[model samples]
Target: MNQLEALKRWTTVVADTGDFQQMEQFRPQDATTNPSLILKAVQKPEYAPLLQQVVAQGKGAEISALMDQLIVRFGCEILTKVPGRVSTEVDARLSFDAAATVARAQRIVALYRAQGVDTASRVLIKVAATWEGIQAAGQLEREGIHTNLTLLFSRCQAIACGDAGVQLISPFVGRIYDWYKKQAGAGWDEAAMAGDNDPGVQSVRSIFDYYKHFGIRTEVMGASFRNVGQILALAGCDLLTIAPDLLAQLQAASGDVPHKLNAAAAQGMALERVHYDEAGFRFALNADAMATEKLAEGIRAFVADAVKLEQLMQAAAV
Candidate 1:
Protein backbone atom coordinates (compact mmCIF):
# COMPACT_ATOMS: atom_id res chain seq x y z
CA MET A 1 0.00 0.00 0.00
CA ASN A 2 1.13 3.54 -0.67
CA GLN A 3 1.81 5.91 2.19
CA LEU A 4 -1.64 7.45 1.84
CA GLU A 5 -3.24 4.06 2.30
CA ALA A 6 -0.78 3.24 5.05
CA LEU A 7 -1.42 6.49 6.83
CA LYS A 8 -5.13 5.69 6.81
CA ARG A 9 -4.36 2.66 8.93
CA TRP A 10 -3.35 4.96 11.75
CA THR A 11 -4.96 8.27 10.90
CA THR A 12 -8.23 9.51 9.51
CA VAL A 13 -7.24 11.32 6.32
CA VAL A 14 -9.41 14.30 5.46
CA ALA A 15 -9.33 16.18 2.17
CA ASP A 16 -8.80 19.86 2.90
CA THR A 17 -10.24 21.48 -0.22
CA GLY A 18 -13.31 23.31 -1.35
CA ASP A 19 -13.20 21.47 -4.67
CA PHE A 20 -15.44 18.45 -4.24
CA GLN A 21 -14.31 17.26 -7.68
CA GLN A 22 -10.85 16.58 -6.30
CA MET A 23 -11.95 14.56 -3.24
CA GLU A 24 -13.14 11.30 -4.85
CA GLN A 25 -9.59 10.25 -5.72
CA PHE A 26 -8.01 10.57 -2.24
CA ARG A 27 -11.08 9.17 -0.51
CA PRO A 28 -10.62 11.21 2.65
CA GLN A 29 -12.92 10.06 5.41
CA ASP A 30 -13.89 13.71 6.06
CA ALA A 31 -13.50 17.10 4.35
CA THR A 32 -12.80 20.63 5.56
CA THR A 33 -13.50 24.04 4.02
CA ASN A 34 -12.82 27.65 4.95
CA PRO A 35 -13.68 31.00 3.41
CA SER A 36 -10.28 30.92 1.71
CA LEU A 37 -11.14 27.60 0.03
CA ILE A 38 -14.64 28.66 -1.01
CA LEU A 39 -13.14 31.83 -2.52
CA LYS A 40 -10.61 29.75 -4.46
CA ALA A 41 -13.25 27.27 -5.66
CA VAL A 42 -15.68 29.89 -6.97
CA GLN A 43 -12.87 31.43 -9.04
CA LYS A 44 -12.30 28.20 -10.98
CA PRO A 45 -13.90 27.82 -14.42
CA GLU A 46 -15.46 24.47 -13.58
CA TYR A 47 -16.83 25.84 -10.34
CA ALA A 48 -17.78 29.29 -11.62
CA PRO A 49 -21.20 28.00 -12.57
CA LEU A 50 -21.69 26.78 -9.01
CA LEU A 51 -21.27 30.42 -8.04
CA GLN A 52 -23.59 31.63 -10.83
CA GLN A 53 -26.06 28.82 -10.29
CA VAL A 54 -26.35 29.40 -6.56
CA VAL A 55 -26.74 33.14 -7.09
CA ALA A 56 -29.16 32.59 -9.98
CA GLN A 57 -31.19 30.13 -7.92
CA GLY A 58 -31.38 32.67 -5.17
CA LYS A 59 -32.06 35.63 -7.49
CA GLY A 60 -34.97 36.94 -5.45
CA ALA A 61 -33.40 36.15 -2.07
CA GLU A 62 -31.51 38.36 0.36
CA ILE A 63 -27.72 38.57 -0.03
CA SER A 64 -27.14 36.91 3.34
CA ALA A 65 -29.56 34.17 2.39
CA LEU A 66 -27.77 33.71 -0.94
CA MET A 67 -24.40 33.50 0.77
CA ASP A 68 -25.63 30.86 3.18
CA GLN A 69 -27.21 28.96 0.30
CA LEU A 70 -23.96 29.05 -1.67
CA ILE A 71 -21.94 27.74 1.30
CA VAL A 72 -24.36 24.87 1.92
CA ARG A 73 -24.45 24.12 -1.80
CA PHE A 74 -20.73 23.48 -1.63
CA GLY A 75 -21.08 21.46 1.54
CA CYS A 76 -23.99 19.53 0.05
CA GLU A 77 -21.95 18.69 -3.02
CA ILE A 78 -18.92 17.75 -0.95
CA LEU A 79 -20.98 15.40 1.22
CA THR A 80 -21.87 13.37 -1.88
CA LYS A 81 -18.17 12.74 -2.67
CA VAL A 82 -16.87 12.01 0.85
CA PRO A 83 -18.29 9.45 3.23
CA GLY A 84 -17.86 11.63 6.32
CA ARG A 85 -18.68 15.13 7.54
CA VAL A 86 -18.05 18.43 5.69
CA SER A 87 -16.82 21.49 7.56
CA THR A 88 -18.52 24.75 6.59
CA GLU A 89 -17.22 27.89 8.26
CA VAL A 90 -19.04 30.73 9.93
CA ASP A 91 -18.23 34.40 9.12
CA ALA A 92 -14.81 35.29 10.50
CA ARG A 93 -15.88 38.91 10.85
CA LEU A 94 -17.91 37.71 13.84
CA SER A 95 -14.96 35.97 15.49
CA PHE A 96 -14.94 38.36 18.42
CA ASP A 97 -18.70 38.32 18.97
CA ALA A 98 -19.88 35.17 20.75
CA ALA A 99 -23.61 35.52 20.25
CA ALA A 100 -23.24 36.58 16.62
CA THR A 101 -20.93 33.66 15.92
CA VAL A 102 -23.40 31.26 17.51
CA ALA A 103 -26.26 32.69 15.48
CA ARG A 104 -24.29 32.44 12.22
CA ALA A 105 -23.26 28.89 13.01
CA GLN A 106 -26.90 27.97 13.64
CA ARG A 107 -27.87 29.62 10.36
CA ILE A 108 -25.23 27.67 8.45
CA VAL A 109 -26.31 24.40 10.05
CA ALA A 110 -29.95 25.25 9.42
CA LEU A 111 -29.14 25.84 5.76
CA TYR A 112 -27.54 22.42 5.52
CA ARG A 113 -30.52 20.87 7.25
CA ALA A 114 -32.93 22.55 4.82
CA GLN A 115 -31.17 20.74 1.98
CA GLY A 116 -31.93 17.38 3.69
CA VAL A 117 -28.19 16.82 4.09
CA ASP A 118 -28.50 14.87 7.41
CA THR A 119 -26.32 17.61 8.88
CA ALA A 120 -27.06 16.69 12.47
CA SER A 121 -24.04 14.38 12.71
CA ARG A 122 -22.31 14.86 9.36
CA VAL A 123 -21.68 18.59 9.52
CA LEU A 124 -18.91 20.36 11.39
CA ILE A 125 -19.51 24.06 11.88
CA LYS A 126 -16.08 25.64 11.51
CA VAL A 127 -15.39 28.60 13.78
CA ALA A 128 -12.37 30.76 14.57
CA ALA A 129 -10.58 29.65 17.78
CA THR A 130 -11.15 32.86 19.67
CA TRP A 131 -12.41 32.77 23.26
CA GLU A 132 -15.69 34.02 21.94
CA GLY A 133 -15.64 31.45 19.20
CA ILE A 134 -14.92 28.64 21.64
CA GLN A 135 -17.71 29.82 23.91
CA ALA A 136 -20.04 29.92 20.92
CA ALA A 137 -19.05 26.40 20.01
CA GLY A 138 -19.76 25.27 23.55
CA GLN A 139 -23.27 26.62 23.29
CA LEU A 140 -23.76 25.07 19.87
CA GLU A 141 -22.51 21.71 21.11
CA ARG A 142 -25.26 21.77 23.72
CA GLU A 143 -27.73 22.17 20.90
CA GLY A 144 -26.34 19.03 19.19
CA ILE A 145 -24.12 21.08 16.91
CA HIS A 146 -20.60 19.78 16.30
CA THR A 147 -17.81 22.32 15.76
CA ASN A 148 -14.35 22.36 14.19
CA LEU A 149 -12.23 25.10 15.70
CA THR A 150 -10.20 26.81 12.96
CA LEU A 151 -7.42 29.45 13.01
CA LEU A 152 -5.98 27.62 16.01
CA PHE A 153 -2.26 28.04 16.81
CA SER A 154 -1.36 28.30 20.50
CA ARG A 155 -1.57 25.41 22.98
CA CYS A 156 -3.93 27.63 24.94
CA GLN A 157 -6.23 27.66 21.95
CA ALA A 158 -6.19 23.87 21.86
CA ILE A 159 -6.82 23.60 25.59
CA ALA A 160 -9.68 26.05 25.38
CA CYS A 161 -11.26 24.13 22.54
CA GLY A 162 -11.04 20.85 24.43
CA ASP A 163 -12.28 22.43 27.62
CA ALA A 164 -15.22 23.81 25.77
CA GLY A 165 -15.90 20.26 24.57
CA VAL A 166 -15.75 21.11 20.89
CA GLN A 167 -16.04 18.18 18.51
CA LEU A 168 -12.65 18.96 16.93
CA ILE A 169 -9.83 21.49 16.64
CA SER A 170 -7.67 22.08 13.59
CA PRO A 171 -4.18 23.27 14.52
CA PHE A 172 -2.66 24.72 11.37
CA VAL A 173 0.82 23.28 10.86
CA GLY A 174 2.03 25.15 7.79
CA ARG A 175 0.93 28.57 9.03
CA ILE A 176 2.77 28.00 12.30
CA TYR A 177 5.91 27.05 10.36
CA ASP A 178 5.53 30.05 8.06
CA TRP A 179 5.64 32.56 10.93
CA TYR A 180 8.65 31.01 12.66
CA LYS A 181 10.53 30.43 9.40
CA LYS A 182 10.10 34.04 8.31
CA GLN A 183 10.95 35.29 11.77
CA ALA A 184 13.98 33.00 12.17
CA GLY A 185 15.31 33.79 8.70
CA ALA A 186 18.37 31.58 8.07
CA GLY A 187 17.91 29.86 11.41
CA TRP A 188 15.22 27.53 10.05
CA ASP A 189 16.69 24.23 8.92
CA GLU A 190 15.28 21.69 6.48
CA ALA A 191 17.10 18.75 8.11
CA ALA A 192 14.60 18.67 10.94
CA MET A 193 11.94 17.51 8.52
CA ALA A 194 9.94 15.00 10.50
CA GLY A 195 8.75 13.92 13.93
CA ASP A 196 9.13 16.41 16.79
CA ASN A 197 11.51 18.63 14.84
CA ASP A 198 8.81 19.71 12.39
CA PRO A 199 7.19 22.87 13.71
CA GLY A 200 3.79 21.95 12.39
CA VAL A 201 4.01 18.34 13.49
CA GLN A 202 5.32 19.41 16.87
CA SER A 203 2.38 21.73 17.34
CA VAL A 204 -0.07 18.98 16.57
CA ARG A 205 1.81 16.51 18.73
CA SER A 206 1.84 18.92 21.63
CA ILE A 207 -1.91 19.36 21.31
CA PHE A 208 -2.48 15.66 20.78
CA ASP A 209 -0.34 14.64 23.75
CA TYR A 210 -2.13 17.06 25.99
CA TYR A 211 -5.55 15.82 24.92
CA LYS A 212 -4.66 12.16 25.18
CA HIS A 213 -2.95 12.70 28.52
CA PHE A 214 -6.12 14.11 29.98
CA GLY A 215 -8.46 11.87 27.99
CA ILE A 216 -10.09 14.88 26.43
CA ARG A 217 -12.67 13.71 23.94
CA THR A 218 -12.19 16.47 21.41
CA GLU A 219 -10.36 15.49 18.20
CA VAL A 220 -7.09 17.03 16.95
CA MET A 221 -6.77 17.61 13.22
CA GLY A 222 -3.50 18.86 11.79
CA ALA A 223 -4.10 21.39 9.02
CA SER A 224 -2.31 23.89 6.71
CA PHE A 225 0.48 21.55 5.78
CA ARG A 226 3.49 22.73 3.74
CA ASN A 227 4.48 19.24 2.53
CA VAL A 228 3.88 15.53 2.77
CA GLY A 229 6.75 15.38 5.25
CA GLN A 230 4.71 17.34 7.74
CA ILE A 231 1.75 15.03 7.15
CA LEU A 232 3.90 11.93 7.52
CA ALA A 233 5.34 13.30 10.75
CA LEU A 234 1.86 13.34 12.19
CA ALA A 235 1.01 9.92 10.76
CA GLY A 236 -0.89 8.82 13.83
CA CYS A 237 -2.61 12.11 14.46
CA ASP A 238 -6.34 11.94 15.13
CA LEU A 239 -6.80 13.33 11.63
CA LEU A 240 -4.78 15.25 9.05
CA THR A 241 -6.70 17.45 6.65
CA ILE A 242 -4.74 17.66 3.38
CA ALA A 243 -5.37 19.43 0.13
CA PRO A 244 -5.99 17.23 -2.91
CA ASP A 245 -2.50 17.86 -4.34
CA LEU A 246 -0.74 16.68 -1.18
CA LEU A 247 -3.04 13.67 -0.96
CA ALA A 248 -1.94 12.78 -4.48
CA GLN A 249 1.71 12.96 -3.41
CA LEU A 250 1.13 10.65 -0.46
CA GLN A 251 -0.72 8.20 -2.71
CA ALA A 252 2.25 8.02 -5.09
CA ALA A 253 4.85 7.30 -2.42
CA SER A 254 5.63 3.71 -1.27
CA GLY A 255 7.58 4.56 1.86
CA ASP A 256 7.10 2.67 5.08
CA VAL A 257 4.64 4.95 6.79
CA PRO A 258 5.23 4.07 10.39
CA HIS A 259 2.90 5.16 13.16
CA LYS A 260 4.74 8.19 14.51
CA LEU A 261 2.20 9.44 17.06
CA ASN A 262 0.34 6.97 19.23
CA ALA A 263 -2.10 7.82 21.98
CA ALA A 264 -0.59 5.26 24.32
CA ALA A 265 2.83 6.72 23.74
CA ALA A 266 1.45 10.19 24.21
CA GLN A 267 -0.20 9.24 27.48
CA GLY A 268 3.12 8.10 28.85
CA MET A 269 4.81 11.37 27.95
CA ALA A 270 5.60 14.06 30.52
CA LEU A 271 3.37 16.78 29.16
CA GLU A 272 0.41 17.61 31.41
CA ARG A 273 -2.99 18.86 30.45
CA VAL A 274 -3.42 22.61 30.85
CA HIS A 275 -6.48 24.59 31.83
CA TYR A 276 -6.56 28.13 30.48
CA ASP A 277 -8.90 30.90 31.52
CA GLU A 278 -9.49 33.90 29.26
CA ALA A 279 -6.57 35.87 30.69
CA GLY A 280 -4.23 32.88 30.64
CA PHE A 281 -5.25 32.00 27.10
CA ARG A 282 -4.54 35.54 25.96
CA PHE A 283 -1.24 35.79 27.83
CA ALA A 284 0.03 32.44 26.54
CA LEU A 285 -1.05 33.18 23.00
CA ASN A 286 0.48 36.67 23.16
CA ALA A 287 3.76 35.21 24.40
CA ASP A 288 3.97 32.80 21.48
CA ALA A 289 5.20 34.89 18.53
CA MET A 290 4.21 32.38 15.86
CA ALA A 291 0.76 31.76 17.33
CA THR A 292 0.01 35.47 17.70
CA GLU A 293 1.19 36.28 14.20
CA LYS A 294 -0.52 33.35 12.48
CA LEU A 295 -3.78 33.78 14.38
CA ALA A 296 -3.96 37.39 13.16
CA GLU A 297 -2.96 36.36 9.64
CA GLY A 298 -5.53 33.57 9.51
CA ILE A 299 -8.32 35.91 10.64
CA ARG A 300 -7.29 38.63 8.13
CA ALA A 301 -7.18 36.14 5.27
CA PHE A 302 -10.61 34.81 6.19
CA VAL A 303 -12.02 38.36 6.44
CA ALA A 304 -10.64 39.12 2.96
CA ASP A 305 -12.30 36.02 1.56
CA ALA A 306 -15.54 36.95 3.33
CA VAL A 307 -15.36 40.36 1.59
CA LYS A 308 -14.74 38.76 -1.80
CA LEU A 309 -17.73 36.52 -1.16
CA GLU A 310 -19.77 39.62 -0.38
CA GLN A 311 -18.66 41.17 -3.67
CA LEU A 312 -19.77 38.07 -5.51
CA MET A 313 -23.11 38.27 -3.75
CA GLN A 314 -23.44 42.00 -4.52
CA ALA A 315 -22.70 41.51 -8.21
CA ALA A 316 -25.30 38.78 -8.33
CA ALA A 317 -27.73 41.03 -6.47
CA VAL A 318 -27.70 43.39 -9.46
Candidate 2:
Protein backbone atom coordinates (compact mmCIF):
# COMPACT_ATOMS: atom_id res chain seq x y z
CA MET A 1 0.00 0.00 0.00
CA ASN A 2 1.08 3.59 -0.57
CA GLN A 3 2.13 5.56 2.49
CA LEU A 4 -1.17 7.47 2.50
CA GLU A 5 -3.15 4.23 2.56
CA ALA A 6 -0.80 2.69 5.09
CA LEU A 7 -0.86 5.78 7.28
CA LYS A 8 -4.63 5.57 7.45
CA ARG A 9 -4.30 2.19 9.12
CA TRP A 10 -2.90 3.95 12.17
CA THR A 11 -4.01 7.61 11.95
CA THR A 12 -6.91 9.58 10.56
CA VAL A 13 -5.69 11.72 7.65
CA VAL A 14 -7.54 14.98 7.05
CA ALA A 15 -7.08 17.25 4.04
CA ASP A 16 -6.09 20.69 5.25
CA THR A 17 -7.08 23.12 2.52
CA GLY A 18 -9.90 25.18 1.09
CA ASP A 19 -9.18 23.47 -2.24
CA PHE A 20 -11.63 20.63 -1.91
CA GLN A 21 -11.09 19.76 -5.60
CA GLN A 22 -7.66 18.45 -4.64
CA MET A 23 -9.11 16.16 -1.95
CA GLU A 24 -10.66 13.43 -4.16
CA GLN A 25 -7.22 12.26 -5.28
CA PHE A 26 -5.83 11.83 -1.75
CA ARG A 27 -9.20 10.66 -0.40
CA PRO A 28 -8.78 12.31 2.98
CA GLN A 29 -11.36 11.48 5.63
CA ASP A 30 -12.35 15.11 6.37
CA ALA A 31 -11.38 18.61 5.19
CA THR A 32 -10.46 21.88 6.94
CA THR A 33 -10.64 25.50 5.68
CA ASN A 34 -9.62 28.84 7.14
CA PRO A 35 -9.99 32.43 5.96
CA SER A 36 -6.45 32.41 4.54
CA LEU A 37 -6.89 29.09 2.71
CA ILE A 38 -10.26 30.16 1.36
CA LEU A 39 -8.77 33.48 0.29
CA LYS A 40 -6.02 31.68 -1.58
CA ALA A 41 -8.47 29.25 -3.22
CA VAL A 42 -10.82 31.98 -4.48
CA GLN A 43 -7.89 33.73 -6.12
CA LYS A 44 -7.35 30.71 -8.36
CA PRO A 45 -8.99 30.67 -11.80
CA GLU A 46 -11.31 27.71 -11.27
CA TYR A 47 -12.55 29.12 -7.97
CA ALA A 48 -12.93 32.70 -9.18
CA PRO A 49 -16.43 31.97 -10.41
CA LEU A 50 -17.42 30.81 -6.94
CA LEU A 51 -16.59 34.30 -5.75
CA GLN A 52 -18.44 35.86 -8.71
CA GLN A 53 -21.54 33.79 -8.04
CA VAL A 54 -21.65 34.71 -4.40
CA VAL A 55 -21.11 38.36 -5.26
CA ALA A 56 -23.81 38.41 -7.92
CA GLN A 57 -26.30 36.84 -5.57
CA GLY A 58 -25.28 39.07 -2.71
CA LYS A 59 -27.01 42.12 -4.25
CA GLY A 60 -24.95 44.74 -2.41
CA ALA A 61 -25.31 43.08 0.96
CA GLU A 62 -22.75 43.53 3.72
CA ILE A 63 -19.38 42.34 2.45
CA SER A 64 -18.62 40.51 5.67
CA ALA A 65 -21.94 38.69 5.39
CA LEU A 66 -21.19 37.88 1.77
CA MET A 67 -17.81 36.52 2.82
CA ASP A 68 -19.55 34.29 5.31
CA GLN A 69 -21.99 33.11 2.61
CA LEU A 70 -19.12 32.45 0.25
CA ILE A 71 -17.35 30.43 2.91
CA VAL A 72 -20.50 28.36 3.40
CA ARG A 73 -20.91 27.91 -0.36
CA PHE A 74 -17.41 26.47 -0.57
CA GLY A 75 -18.13 24.27 2.44
CA CYS A 76 -21.44 23.15 1.00
CA GLU A 77 -19.66 22.23 -2.21
CA ILE A 78 -16.98 20.40 -0.21
CA LEU A 79 -19.50 18.37 1.80
CA THR A 80 -20.95 16.94 -1.42
CA LYS A 81 -17.53 15.52 -2.15
CA VAL A 82 -16.48 14.14 1.27
CA PRO A 83 -18.39 11.74 3.49
CA GLY A 84 -17.20 13.40 6.70
CA ARG A 85 -17.56 16.92 8.14
CA VAL A 86 -16.11 20.20 6.82
CA SER A 87 -14.70 22.91 9.10
CA THR A 88 -15.96 26.44 8.30
CA GLU A 89 -14.35 29.21 10.32
CA VAL A 90 -16.05 31.91 12.29
CA ASP A 91 -14.74 35.46 11.63
CA ALA A 92 -11.39 35.76 13.37
CA ARG A 93 -12.25 39.43 13.84
CA LEU A 94 -14.58 38.19 16.52
CA SER A 95 -11.92 36.18 18.31
CA PHE A 96 -11.95 38.44 21.35
CA ASP A 97 -15.66 38.98 21.75
CA ALA A 98 -16.99 35.66 22.98
CA ALA A 99 -20.66 36.46 22.38
CA ALA A 100 -20.04 37.86 18.91
CA THR A 101 -17.98 34.85 17.97
CA VAL A 102 -20.70 32.55 19.26
CA ALA A 103 -23.29 34.46 17.27
CA ARG A 104 -21.28 34.29 14.06
CA ALA A 105 -20.73 30.54 14.56
CA GLN A 106 -24.49 30.13 15.05
CA ARG A 107 -25.16 31.92 11.78
CA ILE A 108 -22.70 29.71 9.94
CA VAL A 109 -24.39 26.64 11.38
CA ALA A 110 -27.79 28.09 10.58
CA LEU A 111 -26.86 28.62 6.94
CA TYR A 112 -25.91 24.96 6.69
CA ARG A 113 -29.13 23.92 8.38
CA ALA A 114 -31.19 26.06 6.03
CA GLN A 115 -29.77 24.05 3.17
CA GLY A 116 -31.05 20.86 4.85
CA VAL A 117 -27.62 20.18 6.28
CA ASP A 118 -27.81 18.83 9.84
CA THR A 119 -24.40 20.23 10.71
CA ALA A 120 -24.64 19.08 14.29
CA SER A 121 -23.46 15.74 12.94
CA ARG A 122 -21.32 16.86 9.95
CA VAL A 123 -19.64 20.16 10.82
CA LEU A 124 -16.86 21.46 13.02
CA ILE A 125 -17.07 25.20 13.69
CA LYS A 126 -13.43 26.34 13.58
CA VAL A 127 -12.65 28.91 16.26
CA ALA A 128 -9.37 30.51 17.29
CA ALA A 129 -7.91 29.20 20.57
CA THR A 130 -8.06 32.44 22.48
CA TRP A 131 -9.29 32.33 26.08
CA GLU A 132 -12.43 34.01 24.80
CA GLY A 133 -12.62 31.50 21.96
CA ILE A 134 -12.33 28.64 24.44
CA GLN A 135 -15.16 30.10 26.49
CA ALA A 136 -17.24 30.52 23.35
CA ALA A 137 -16.53 26.91 22.45
CA GLY A 138 -17.70 25.81 25.87
CA GLN A 139 -20.98 27.63 25.36
CA LEU A 140 -21.41 26.24 21.86
CA GLU A 141 -20.59 22.69 23.02
CA ARG A 142 -23.35 22.90 25.60
CA GLU A 143 -25.69 23.72 22.73
CA GLY A 144 -24.32 20.75 20.74
CA ILE A 145 -22.01 22.65 18.44
CA HIS A 146 -19.01 20.50 17.52
CA THR A 147 -16.02 22.86 17.57
CA ASN A 148 -12.50 22.50 16.14
CA LEU A 149 -10.35 24.88 18.13
CA THR A 150 -7.81 26.28 15.66
CA LEU A 151 -4.59 28.31 16.26
CA LEU A 152 -3.85 26.27 19.36
CA PHE A 153 -0.14 26.24 20.35
CA SER A 154 0.40 25.57 24.06
CA ARG A 155 -0.63 22.83 26.47
CA CYS A 156 -2.57 25.51 28.32
CA GLN A 157 -4.68 26.18 25.26
CA ALA A 158 -5.30 22.47 24.72
CA ILE A 159 -6.18 21.91 28.36
CA ALA A 160 -8.57 24.85 28.33
CA CYS A 161 -10.27 23.52 25.22
CA GLY A 162 -10.61 20.04 26.71
CA ASP A 163 -11.90 21.52 29.93
CA ALA A 164 -14.36 23.52 27.88
CA GLY A 165 -15.57 20.24 26.36
CA VAL A 166 -14.41 21.17 22.88
CA GLN A 167 -14.83 18.39 20.34
CA LEU A 168 -11.27 18.88 19.01
CA ILE A 169 -8.23 21.18 18.99
CA SER A 170 -5.90 21.82 16.01
CA PRO A 171 -2.33 22.53 17.18
CA PHE A 172 -0.49 24.12 14.30
CA VAL A 173 2.71 22.38 13.12
CA GLY A 174 4.19 24.52 10.31
CA ARG A 175 3.79 28.02 11.63
CA ILE A 176 5.44 26.93 14.84
CA TYR A 177 8.47 25.93 12.76
CA ASP A 178 8.47 29.28 10.98
CA TRP A 179 8.78 31.19 14.26
CA TYR A 180 11.76 29.13 15.39
CA LYS A 181 13.38 29.16 11.97
CA LYS A 182 13.28 32.95 11.85
CA GLN A 183 14.60 33.12 15.39
CA ALA A 184 17.42 30.59 14.87
CA GLY A 185 18.87 32.71 11.99
CA ALA A 186 22.10 30.68 11.34
CA GLY A 187 22.39 27.84 13.82
CA TRP A 188 19.57 25.74 12.32
CA ASP A 189 20.53 22.51 10.55
CA GLU A 190 18.81 21.87 7.24
CA ALA A 191 18.22 18.08 7.39
CA ALA A 192 18.96 16.99 10.92
CA MET A 193 15.98 18.76 12.45
CA ALA A 194 14.14 19.71 9.29
CA GLY A 195 11.55 16.99 9.10
CA ASP A 196 10.72 14.92 12.16
CA ASN A 197 12.77 16.87 14.71
CA ASP A 198 10.92 20.05 13.82
CA PRO A 199 9.85 22.21 16.74
CA GLY A 200 6.24 22.19 15.50
CA VAL A 201 6.07 18.39 15.60
CA GLN A 202 7.52 18.49 19.09
CA SER A 203 4.76 20.89 20.21
CA VAL A 204 1.97 18.64 18.98
CA ARG A 205 3.65 15.59 20.47
CA SER A 206 3.65 17.26 23.86
CA ILE A 207 -0.07 17.93 23.58
CA PHE A 208 -0.79 14.41 22.31
CA ASP A 209 1.18 12.77 25.11
CA TYR A 210 -0.60 14.80 27.73
CA TYR A 211 -4.02 14.13 26.26
CA LYS A 212 -3.43 10.40 26.00
CA HIS A 213 -2.04 10.23 29.50
CA PHE A 214 -5.07 11.99 30.95
CA GLY A 215 -7.58 10.21 28.73
CA ILE A 216 -9.00 13.55 27.64
CA ARG A 217 -11.89 12.92 25.26
CA THR A 218 -11.05 15.97 23.16
CA GLU A 219 -9.39 15.02 19.87
CA VAL A 220 -6.00 16.48 18.85
CA MET A 221 -5.80 17.40 15.16
CA GLY A 222 -2.39 18.76 14.11
CA ALA A 223 -2.67 21.56 11.55
CA SER A 224 -0.67 24.19 9.54
CA PHE A 225 2.39 22.10 8.74
CA ARG A 226 5.36 22.79 6.44
CA ASN A 227 6.69 19.32 5.57
CA VAL A 228 5.81 15.66 5.05
CA GLY A 229 8.27 14.71 7.80
CA GLN A 230 6.28 16.67 10.37
CA ILE A 231 3.18 14.76 9.32
CA LEU A 232 4.99 11.43 9.40
CA ALA A 233 6.44 12.17 12.82
CA LEU A 234 2.93 12.77 14.07
CA ALA A 235 1.67 9.42 12.86
CA GLY A 236 -0.79 7.79 15.28
CA CYS A 237 -2.10 11.17 16.39
CA ASP A 238 -5.89 11.43 16.59
CA LEU A 239 -5.74 13.20 13.23
CA LEU A 240 -3.26 15.14 11.14
CA THR A 241 -4.78 17.71 8.77
CA ILE A 242 -2.27 18.14 5.96
CA ALA A 243 -2.08 20.38 2.92
CA PRO A 244 -2.65 18.77 -0.50
CA ASP A 245 0.96 19.13 -1.66
CA LEU A 246 2.27 17.36 1.43
CA LEU A 247 -0.48 14.78 1.20
CA ALA A 248 0.46 14.10 -2.42
CA GLN A 249 4.14 13.78 -1.46
CA LEU A 250 3.36 11.26 1.24
CA GLN A 251 1.29 9.27 -1.25
CA ALA A 252 4.14 9.31 -3.77
CA ALA A 253 6.98 8.17 -1.53
CA SER A 254 7.67 4.50 -0.88
CA GLY A 255 9.08 3.69 2.51
CA ASP A 256 8.37 2.23 5.90
CA VAL A 257 6.30 4.98 7.47
CA PRO A 258 6.23 3.71 10.99
CA HIS A 259 3.86 4.85 13.68
CA LYS A 260 5.78 7.43 15.73
CA LEU A 261 3.14 8.40 18.26
CA ASN A 262 0.57 6.42 20.22
CA ALA A 263 -0.91 5.83 23.64
CA ALA A 264 1.65 3.11 24.34
CA ALA A 265 4.58 5.27 23.29
CA ALA A 266 3.21 8.33 25.07
CA GLN A 267 3.02 6.29 28.24
CA GLY A 268 6.79 6.18 28.33
CA MET A 269 7.17 9.96 27.94
CA ALA A 270 7.90 12.25 30.90
CA LEU A 271 5.03 14.66 30.24
CA GLU A 272 2.25 14.48 32.79
CA ARG A 273 -1.44 15.21 32.52
CA VAL A 274 -1.72 19.00 32.33
CA HIS A 275 -4.17 21.06 34.38
CA TYR A 276 -4.50 24.77 33.54
CA ASP A 277 -6.68 27.24 35.34
CA GLU A 278 -6.78 30.84 34.10
CA ALA A 279 -3.59 31.93 35.80
CA GLY A 280 -1.76 28.75 34.86
CA PHE A 281 -2.95 29.06 31.28
CA ARG A 282 -1.51 32.57 31.05
CA PHE A 283 1.78 31.56 32.60
CA ALA A 284 2.12 28.42 30.46
CA LEU A 285 1.32 30.25 27.23
CA ASN A 286 3.79 32.97 28.14
CA ALA A 287 6.47 30.34 28.79
CA ASP A 288 6.50 28.99 25.23
CA ALA A 289 7.83 31.50 22.68
CA MET A 290 6.84 29.39 19.67
CA ALA A 291 3.32 28.98 20.96
CA THR A 292 3.02 32.61 22.00
CA GLU A 293 4.46 34.06 18.77
CA LYS A 294 2.55 31.62 16.57
CA LEU A 295 -0.69 32.06 18.48
CA ALA A 296 -0.56 35.84 18.17
CA GLU A 297 0.68 35.63 14.59
CA GLY A 298 -1.98 33.12 13.59
CA ILE A 299 -4.71 35.34 14.96
CA ARG A 300 -3.31 38.38 13.14
CA ALA A 301 -3.04 36.47 9.87
CA PHE A 302 -6.63 35.21 10.15
CA VAL A 303 -7.89 38.65 11.04
CA ALA A 304 -6.05 40.18 8.09
CA ASP A 305 -7.52 37.66 5.68
CA ALA A 306 -10.95 38.08 7.15
CA VAL A 307 -10.56 41.80 6.45
CA LYS A 308 -9.28 41.04 2.98
CA LEU A 309 -12.18 38.68 2.37
CA GLU A 310 -14.63 41.42 3.25
CA GLN A 311 -12.86 43.75 0.85
CA LEU A 312 -13.04 41.14 -1.91
CA MET A 313 -16.76 40.88 -1.36
CA GLN A 314 -17.09 44.66 -1.65
CA ALA A 315 -14.93 44.80 -4.78
CA ALA A 316 -16.93 41.96 -6.31
CA ALA A 317 -20.20 43.67 -5.36
CA VAL A 318 -20.59 45.76 -8.47
Best by lDDT: 1
lDDT of 2 at 121: 83
TM for candidate 1 is 0.96
The local lDDT score (0 to 100) that residue 185 gets in candidate 1 is 86
Best by TM-score: 1
lDDT of prediction 1: 0.89
| Candidate 2 lDDT score at position 77 | 87
Worst 10 residues of 1 by lDDT: 187-196
Q: At residue 178, what lDDT does model 2 achieve? A: 83
lDDT of 2 by residue, 216-266 (tens): 889999988787778888888999898998888989987777888888777
RMSD of candidate 2 to the truth, in angstroms, is 1.6
How do the residues 17-36 of candidate 1 rate in per-residue lDDT, one tens digit apiece? 99999889888999999888
The alpha-carbon deviation from the true structure for residue 253 of candidate 2, after best TM-score superposition, in angstroms, is 1.2
Clashing pairs in 1: none
Worst-scoring 10-residue span by lDDT in model 2: 266-275
